[model samples]
Target: MKTERAISDEFMNALVDDQLDSDEKDYALREANQNTEFRERVCELRALKEMVQHAYPQVADAPPRTRGRTSLRLSHLQSLAACFMLLMIGGTSGWLAHDISSPASDNQMVHSLRALQQNDFGIHPSKYVVHVDTANPIRLKTALDEAENLLTTAQDTSQPSQVEIIANGPGLDLLRTGISPFAQRIALMQKKYPGLDFMACGQTIRKLKEQGIVVELLPHTQVTPSALEQIITRRLKQNWAYIKV
Candidate 1:
């Protein structure tokens, strides 16, 4: 003989409603008799059916008010929660927009002042000076000639009352042994303008001697140890400006 399996709730319900075939109903009853839990569940279902039949009249008289109220309250709470979430999102988006749109706020006036200071018109003509420190001897001579021309033009126009030419560093070659190509022009400028000063760097002279180049003392030229410092000192103390070309 084969052992019977337990009856499921579906099988019990089918058997109770007379929906099962004879062979299936017999099998379900055999299983239900073997399993105590299944038998108990079937008995409870039968009792519930009888009570539901007796209570059908009372259930028809009442409406589902409690379920409807519960649903309404849940909808209201969900709407409130959704509104709060939207407000938070909107606030966060507003803050990000403000941060992105705002311009640089710190040191704005200071930056504007710095830009004004760098403007070309801030410096005056009398405060200007020129320093020539060229590497090539030919270029040095050419620059000297250009300076002389500029001085003559200034003197003719009387635009710049003060102009000085300080030649130092490698530019000392202009006053050294070999006769400069622009010697005649330089001599003429020196004779024409008494205020034009041509000075050489003493440091460059020492270096030139070490390199075995002879230094000849010239009449219109002067020498100094710290040429760059002297230029800076004159500019700052006497309101003289600088031109490097």
Candidate 2:
């Protein structure tokens, strides 16, 4: 059995080296396809051959130069040549080690590195800000959906836009978890686009809580009643483009 295994190993090597006849090579390749170990060994040999070729300096098909001794010292020339060869071998070994270890992770790292270097800054300017103000639960939800669609279009065109849904007065009730039909949608949109700011009136939150309504709404960064008024005032004062959805 040991002799038979040796003969099989020799046959596989011959097939890989292309020393076998075409029919025999085809049979060996087919057998390798079904044998993971054989396929891996073949790949390993190929990689080793490539590594050796890359590590060693290639000799030119020319006769050695016969020249007189140079002014440069022989020891210095030898040291420089030795350093160059060491550098070549070290570089090749490092590259091969990196290639064979964590290949998938290396590819992912390269992709992430490329993405980090790509800049998508200043590609668009803010065109408009949509303000949704309504008390009716159904209408408020419809308006929010429409506003989201407009924002999507702006993003698709690489155009910037802002949305400020000011739930003030009776409309402020929309920010109450169960009060607004669009509360879930609002939460989803906030997560999807971190840049899109959702503001609820602070006074309204206090009012709702006072009325014994449980309010698990958006974060405090998005809660500003005074800022809502200021936003509206600025849009009106500066005549900034606005749409009420």
Q: Estimate each model's TM-score.
A: 0.44, 0.41
Q: Candidate 2's error at 76, in angstroms?
A: 90
Q: How high is the lDDT of residue 155 in model 1? A: 82
Clashes of each: 1, 0
10 residues in a row with least lDDT, candidate 2: 93-102
lDDT of each: 0.52, 0.50
lDDT of 2 by residue, 1-245 (tens): 22234237677566445567666755665766688777666655544543454344232123436555323333322332233222223323322122223244334433332232243342223534444445755447756776677679877887766656655445665666666666677778877664466667676567667779776764522677543343333432333344443
* Backbone clashes, candidate 1: 1
Pairs of residues at least 3 apart in sequence or in different chains that clash in candidate 2: none
Per-residue C-alpha lDDT of model 1 across residues 79-177, encoded as one tens digit per residue: 222222222232223211111221232123223323333455545555444656555543576567656666777788886555566665556666554
| Model 1 TM-score (2 dp) | 0.44
Give the distance in Å from residue 101's predicted Cα in candidate 1 to where it truly belongs. Answer: 34
Best by TM-score: 1
Where in model 1 is the C-alpha error above 4 Å? 1-124, 177-179
